[model samples]
Target: MFARRALRAAAPAFAAGAAACGATTAWLADEADAGMFVVRPGLSASEYKPLVVGGVRQHTDGTTRVRFVMEEPDLELGAVAAAHLMAKASIDGAEVAGRVAPVSPLTAKGYFELAAAAAGDSAMSKAISSLKTGDVVQFKGPVQGFQVGRNQFKSVGILARGDGIADALQVATKLLSDPRDDTEIRLVYSVRSADQIVLRNHIDALALLHPRFKALIVADEAAPQWTGPTGPLSKPLLASILPPPTEGDSTVILVAGDVDAASGKATKARAAGVLGAMQYSPAQVRSL
Candidate 1:
């Protein structure tokens, strides 16, 4: 749901031999040759040479984690971190744009965890529903937003659900990667089923590796083997998950969810001072 602010369009710039397989007819003005990918017209079936789908893993809960590999091992992704790319996919002739959460990175490959949605009036949901293995999806970004600096905050709380965890992970990785940033982070993620916990192992590894990082996963319906808390997010859950309130304004809480959770519209839940009464909304992604 994290969309970048649109930049001013530049003159049409095409690279030499833009006839790469899966390359779309339209390009983003000046960025066509600058690591920007274009989808084929009518979402035609074609093998993207440099970028190809490597593996597709589907969880029991209908969420999918797809890996994209680059044939060129030396491809430079720029300052784009995992989970920070705003990707637009063409599905059945329709365009659906959403954030692609970075999972793991290798010299020549990357992974993204995507959620499945029930057929509804939402364009993104419909797009997610239409996705299949070997589909050619084009993405271009490192959408501009917050910049990670040294010691930006004393502690940070992240609230997310399903695919939103990728967004939270992006922020966490940025903070933790910088050893100079001593910001403690608390991640509270909500889900409907245990099978939907796609990044559990990775999250656990981060918590185990970093003393300043902690994660709490909440499930709406827990299987008998489940050990974590189970129920809708409420004050008690927030109390147990979030860090103590800070004396200064240095503490921050970043919540990621649908428009309601992000904007605190429904339940009046987030507005109840979950993380020291902090809240802000730059914009909301409207549903289809």
Candidate 2:
């Protein structure tokens, strides 16, 4: 009986190993900080435009209350990439840092949650208290967004120190498989060869399980040896993932650097066809 039990336990491990062998090679780093690309210093912040928008009060838990609103009103909120910046602020010339949090039903339109470690020192806290309804404040960060899960939505908020690509892929895959229901997971990213392999493998894997797990890849141009759907990521694909166009349901993936100008845009377009959108920079991903 003891031998039998031992063998039974080993069976699952053996199966897992076999699955991994057949699975496309995935570059997984254990540091929980892998796949991060950092923004280079000396890049003029002027490239970014700060937007003044309304923020809504969502539910508060502990010291944090979730808020939801489009980071930029003129731009179709769909254009915003997941895990990208929202705003940058400085208090008393001290750089005040905050990441975009995920959106949800509790999150009201034109508002998002901002928290501070304590009370007085954080600019977000001060802004939340001082700013009233319909008051516009200068805010600039990445166009962060979320993914769809089985029954819940995933958060698109990426820290400059967290695992970006891996985390996003994991969330997208889990959202598709675990539920055994009909649902779509949208993702976006700036294209890279390394990530293409992962995206292709993910699509192949999902195709085996869910026929409804449709995908769209959008890119400025095609890459060498690339094998997936390709196009300039369109509004139709964006609509599929974020039906009804609420802040809580959309996610944007941002990629920074001249890479976006070159292979990055093409890669992101490809990734968006299969995933959602590729919009995160290396620095932002590293913070994930």
Candidate 3:
């Protein structure tokens, strides 16, 4: 996690990024102090910049939201959509790297989430996992995304495992404030057990307050009295919550967590006609 002063120093750089396009940024704040989740400008698509970890938020599943403060507070990140972020970290003596999506076309809540250990070995972000406060990470840019060409899908269906919720929770926060109440949003979240479910209050609030949002929470193994959707997290269960995407419906599926879990939803979505669904992995936070 980054220390607080980094945000104060980076604010000007963020302003410059927005200023380059004559666009004024709207910094949205809720649940935290003003400007805590500062939005920095997108970085140059060609180079890697070194940044220090200012702070970190740890989750029970071992995922983390890492906040980096620019070593050069005055440095400017070039532009948004002009480039996306690719992060690298030096863990032990080895180098690790991965692509990060454009969350808000800038920073994703001022910190990036690192996915936990995953199956198939992809999207694990080993370099990032070893980071602690004051650690340095390298960030480069100009990458691809999983969105539908800036068309914000009117409907969002989320399928995430416990390891992925750290970042998905942030996404859910934004959806709550969507101008379109008609935005159809749903979550199919699963964990190993009740103890594995973190941030229960916020999740409950999203379901209760959002007119069109619902959650089907399940546990793979639970006490006999536990009553919720049971999960191994499969395609059949997904079909039950979110129907196949129709030609005219503007829908996007969001997948996060381990590579296997995220891939399952992406694969299922593509097969169901949702060709270009928006995908998210903890390692690739601030994603499109």
Among these predicted structures, which one has the highest lDDT? 1
Q: What are the TM-scores, per candidate, against the unseen true structure?
A: 0.61, 0.29, 0.56
**TM-score winner among the candidates?**
1
TM-score-sorted candidate list, best first: 1, 3, 2
Q: How large is the C-alpha RMSD of every model relative to the true structure?
A: 8.5, 21.9, 9.0
lDDT of each: 0.53, 0.34, 0.51
lDDT of 1 by residue, 178-261 (tens): 655688889887766675565676688899999999999987776987898887666666767675554345666666654234
Residues 30-135 of candidate 2: C-alpha lDDT, one tens digit per residue: 1122332111111112344444434544323213332334443222121112333444554455554443332221112333344311232234444443444454
Sort all candidates by lDDT, best to worst: 1, 3, 2
Q: Runs in model 1 with CA error above 4 Å?
A: 1-51, 57-64, 70-72, 80-83, 88-97, 105-133, 259-288
Better candidate number, 1 or 2, judged by lDDT: 1
